[model samples]
Target: MEQLVFYSLGLGAVIGALGVVTAKNPILSVLSLLWTFFCLACVYLLIGFEFLAVAQILVYAGAIMVLFLFVIMLLNLGTSEAADFDTARAMGRRLPLVLLVGCTLAALSILAAQQVGGTSDEARADLRSVGSLTDLAQVMFGTYLLAFEAASILLLAGTVAVVMLAKRERRKNAA
Candidate 1:
């Protein structure tokens, strides 16, 4: 039953990722990415990482997706003009390389899953403690507080930069 759920989530994630890549509409792509994030969160839950699952939903699906949608709307990229057949041709040419890389990644993921499944029950118990919210909060707030703050500041700076650039471009176009 657990394996079935895991595989289903994995398949959903993969399909969502493909939709994200193939969707020409920016909004559709963002929606697809959100679906992928949700699938990943479910997978995290299945693996007994409750905190990670919540964080994935809150951080990626909630905050990050809102930011992405804001950017897309700000840029007013509703629909892009067709790029003739050049883009299709280019994708076709790279199809084989993409397939090769995807196959390799899939094999590695299966191997890693097998190794994890082979871990002793004791090791799994220890992982549960590590994945606990209390331990995570302590590590994040007590040990990596500075790094966390730095990352927050970086995200703020990036948001400011994007807004400034967009305003400047709008002004230029208005003149």
Candidate 2:
């Protein structure tokens, strides 16, 4: 049952990712990415990482996707009349980079699996604590509190700057 669910979620994620890359419309691509994120969250849940599952849904599927949709709408990128998009040409151009990245990821996955398999039971038990919300909170608030706060402030400042620049641009265009 668990294996079936895992494979189903994995398939959904792969299909969603393919849709994201192949969809002609920006909105449709973003929606496909959202679906991929949801599938990933389900897989995380299946693997006993409840915190990661929730964070994946809330952060990537919710906040990041909303931001993507907002940018697509703000830029009015729904139409492809002005720009000709040759899917085959684009894929050809990126094929080498994609293959390189896929190979690198495969190597890293094999290495990680080997390391995990060689670890003692005690080490593996300790690693499982990493997925616990209590451990996550402790690490975030206790050890990396300052860094976390700094990142949040930086994100806020960036948001404000973008909004200000956009507003100024709109006003100038209106005038």
| Stretch of 10 with least lDDT, candidate 1 | 77-86
The lDDT values for all models are 0.89, 0.88
Q: Write the per-residue lDDT of candidate 1 for residues 1-175, one digit (tens) a residue.
A: 9999999998999999999878888899999999999999998888888899999999999999999999989988745453442387888998999999999998999999788789998988897778878899999899999998899999999999999987897789889
User: What's the lDDT for candidate 1?
Assistant: 0.89
**Model 2 TM-score?**
0.74
Q: TM per model?
A: 0.73, 0.74
